[model samples]
Target: MAGGAAPPSTARGGYRLSALNDDLLQEIITCLPVKEAARTVVLAKRWRYLWPSAPLFLNDADLPQPARDVVVPRVLAEHRGRFRSINLAYFRLASLDRELPGWPRLLADKRTQRLQLTNRNYLPPNQIGTLPHIPADILRCGSLQNLVLGFLKFPVDLSHGVEIFLPNLRELTLAMVIISGEDLEHLITACTALKTLKLTSLTPKRVHLRSRSLRCALVGLSRVEDFAVVDAPLLERLVLYLPGTGARVKIGYAANLLVLGHLDTRVHQLQIRDMVIKSGLKPNTMASTSTLIPSVKILAVTVNFGVLSELNTLASFLRCFPNIVTLHIESVLHDPSVSASAIEPSGEHHAKFWQEVGPVECLRSHVLEKMAIHEFRGDQDEFEFLKFVAMNAQGLQSLHVVLQEGDTSSSDDKKVNEAREKLQDLRFQTGISGVLLVLPKEGILSTLQKATDLTYNDPFRF
Candidate 1:
């Protein structure tokens, strides 16, 4: 038969692919997504069963109930190998509730390492599809390393006798989910090996995280009133994006909290105890005894560019994190459509603030390796901020300034150019090895001839 004519399926593009061994065919199929890989069945007889037989990554989330009932079960039944993953983005929630009790059993048996049950159904604004009880057996999926469930609300309090057995769950992301404070803590505690936890838009009054193995956490845009790190010894990287919330973050108990990225604008108290920041006098926010940042070396903070004209707050902050080696200042550009706030003329203090001063009291003679300011519009605020950094940061090897967008005429270009000239013109140059001006969106606003001068020659030398 091979010597004569090929099968109808392999008569055209099929034969070339079928010529490869099973491993090669599977390698090719693995590169394609689940649906596309399944579509390969029509190519050749060898593939008809191969797609169903391979370690399944079935994504029949969009299929209708009638078709899914037949196709999903049929493929699942025929497949002999364990499933690699399953993504159920869209499905009949009511029907899944009525049936699909064995969903957990199937996932546990198939060894689903990653599962994403994201519901993208069209719904009203601010409305999330509540998830029914996750089959308790699913928690038994010890091999499941990553879990993503969006637009879901658990029926009951997970803390009330609910014991999670997912021992290997390393990363868990829950968005638009209704979980209470105690329940969230309980769920986090359940995942014995959980390292990274991200919660977005979750309505929890208080979230107490106490995990020995927790490393990184991102809590964003949530209605969390109080967030305390009860005990996360291994926690290194923590990001809080509480854009518009009155949430307070307390992290004095944590021993090794290093990198913190905070974006919340609310004047919530940030306490880091057992660490002396400023010795004598303190920033107004410092309620307790002043202690410098104990372990934090990298800090990323978001600031409204319009309000940065005064460097008093930033100066006070740098005093707290005196050992900050790499500082990322992300400027939140205000919409010009929004009416600009009327600025009162500078006061007597303003004259003193603007005058060429010695190194900032906090940054004076300190080894600030690099200062990166995003959205560096050369306005009164940014100009003053840049002058303060350039004059204060003694060991500043590189000054990386990312200019903000401007009136389509490349004000990014204009601002970058002007700022560069101003920095060079500044009489104060302590550790000023180089002055760089760049566009935040674009990399740099320099010429082909002088781009090297703006780029960092040795960022890691320190």
Candidate 2:
């Protein structure tokens, strides 16, 4: 009476997938893609009830489009067990007007722990008249531990204190979410258990950090004039990447702050404690211990080697962190339109500039051990800087030179070999033989999102 003979598992030496217990089967089903997970019901008689019984892990992106409208609602409605996580990033707010109202309540009732809702195909705020705001009730979901929202407007009433509390939330990432500065601050404070926060492409006049639980924060590509850390006792890493015009960074009472940067000399003006870093400030003018932030062991900065003033400014910046052991330098290309005074002479003149720049404290103190130069183009100015660091950073153990990818010059075998040879000569002369590494630019070079990720200690290293 067996249908179509016994399954292959019926053989003496074969194993049966259906033999696994319900709990294990459900867990395995949860690991599959949403659509594939749903298809498990047809595998065997035991799996008929498994898909609906397992906790839901639904991602609209996982399902092929053209039918997401029908599939999403059906799954949400039919699933009998708790909701584990839900990501609805493929639909615009206007298209989900009717269904959106019920989502927050359903997610809350089903105990969803992680939720990401984004508005797809949304235009920039300036180009569009107004964006539809996310349902305010979504903020009331107490079971959420991680939330990522993008291309939507936060509730306008948040600034007026309409009672927002996310006591269990741990990680929050907001990208292109239109919200006022006060509301952003209010929302951040409401999350009493927040640990990691990332904000990108959102303009707030000023961002003031005053959180006790926050550890790592990244703000990138935003038009924020001032980023002030009023008080973050537990904060460790603060990364600011591609900041807009007139951006100023002020650090206040971040006692545990260790990792910082991509501090661009052309854009940002940094102020740590009472010390203000500025051009024309001599690096050798450190008369008091209070002027330096010695606790910072890792630093990343953007420097344009062609700019004479930027190099001088970078020298001053480096002197502020005398104990930094790891340094990351991103060499930006020269802008032909930049003021003539900022552009320095090339070839021999650049070598002369580095020679006269005096001893960088971190390099001479025998504390610097690791350095990575990104976007290396085998230019004279770059070589001059590398030669200075190699010769002066006596304690340097490793130097990583990352050649620019897809660059015609970087692909030239002769030029690359010449660069390698020169770097090898410098290494041998400095007694740091076998410490130089020439690498090509590849992979997903670190992003602000990944940089602020709590898992990595030195996000700027790559």
Candidate 3:
């Protein structure tokens, strides 16, 4: 049979062969260290061609002035047209004027796809003006895709607005940079293909962000989103940090709602599917309140509910999110009595007053489907108050009661144990899932394991 078999085909004609070869080449190139790739040029005539095709990655250590002066010129001379990508990072050139001319020229090559320039220190103020003109030769290049600039300080006269057009750019990250808001707006408008934009620790005097192509945005607390400026029809994720005053204040409005209103008509098609707002509180400044309710599916807020006045205000704000299916309330005033003195009961009798005015069922029915109360201290009064609301509200499917350990008074201990027993009884009688009592740390896990059956299966460890 072996002798009779027809001669094997000599041609390598198959899709599998091509795919395997491509994958093997990618794996081999990825496995090789940069040093090994650079050394390929000295291996032999056959290896010389491979080094030019290798990805060009230049970091501070690889491009020390002495090494750079020798290797850079050689790389540009030989691999100028063959380079697949160029990453120039943490480079400290001896002279801005001397380096600026060649740097942009090197980046302008149609072969360049990734260009990153990060300076360790601020560039000389006088040299800042020369940066924006970014050699017209480089700007005209159509191959660039990702551009990241760090520690860039532009001159005050720089009017290149936020709309700096880069037709092919997809991702842009500007860090520790100073630009005027107008220039920022110009840059946003110019980059029609920009998809992801991150601005951090930037001091833009008057910032305006009006982008038609931006899909994801990350802005600092100091800057507010001017939705009126954004024209992107497919924008999805937005993160903003609103500046906070030290004073404790109630959240009256949803920040997402306010930002969404400012967005242009084209932005209506742009869905803000996710939003996050973070703020710090001052000792006594009035708190920022928001009421803007956008069509968001997921929302998360972290705030200190130390002021009793803010609780109802927050509840009112939450009612606006009609589509919200999940709600989380953290570090809420578990023991409203801690500041009970501050809350003036409306009626003469305190007990009767709470029974009459407390909108417990209103809160349970209006916004919350399932509620999780974190850092909960088992005060019987608070538990009884929650139980009363749970009994009335039909929507509450699950309830998590976390018990935080602190300096427990004798009365407090008795009240906690009684609440645990009462909650257990309620779970058995009403068919409501028993309250989940959790310990805050791992050290107490074993101690709590022996203490109660209600200990959470995986206790939250802080």
In each prediction, how many residue pairs overlap at the backbone (N, C-alpha, C within less than 3 A)? Answer: 7, 0, 39
**Which window of 10 residues has the lowest lDDT sum in candidate 1?**
445-454
TM-score for each predicted model, relative to the true structure: 0.78, 0.88, 0.58
Comparing 1 and 2 on TM-score, the stronger one: 2
Per-residue CA lDDT of candidate 2, range 1-462, in tens? 376566576855446766678899899999998899988888767688998989999989897778787788778877998999898888655545565447667888888899988767778667543766878778888888999998888876786956675788999988887888888888888888999998887857788888889999988745888888888899899888756665878888888889988888877888877777776554344424665778889999988887666777888888888899999998887555667675564546667777777677899888998888888777878888888887788788878887765664434878877777877777523477433345545554356546777677788766
lDDT of each: 0.62, 0.79, 0.46
Cα error, residue 99 of model 2, in Å, equals: 3.7
- Cα lDDT tens digits for candidate 3, 1-462: 476654334234433323344335444553454556677567555555654565555443455556654565455555533344555454444443353446555555535677666665456755654343233344444567887776665544445421133689887777666676766676767778987776665655344566667765555434333322234455544443333211111122223321111111111111122222222112122212232244443333332344333333333334334444344444433233335564432233322322443333224444445555555555443454365445554565666666665534555877677757766766322256647564543353353232222132221222
Residue 7 displacement in candidate 1 (angstroms): 19
* Pairs in clash, predicted candidate 2: none
Write model 1 residue lDDT over 310-407, tens digit each, in one string. Answer: 23344445555666667777655543454555332333444355353333433554656666776555555655656666656666666666654452
Query: Model 2 Cα displacement at 269 (Å)?
Result: 0.6
Which of the two, 1 or 2, has more lDDT? 2
Give the candidate number with the greatest TM-score: 2
All predictions: root-mean-square deviation over Cα? 7.0, 3.6, 11.3
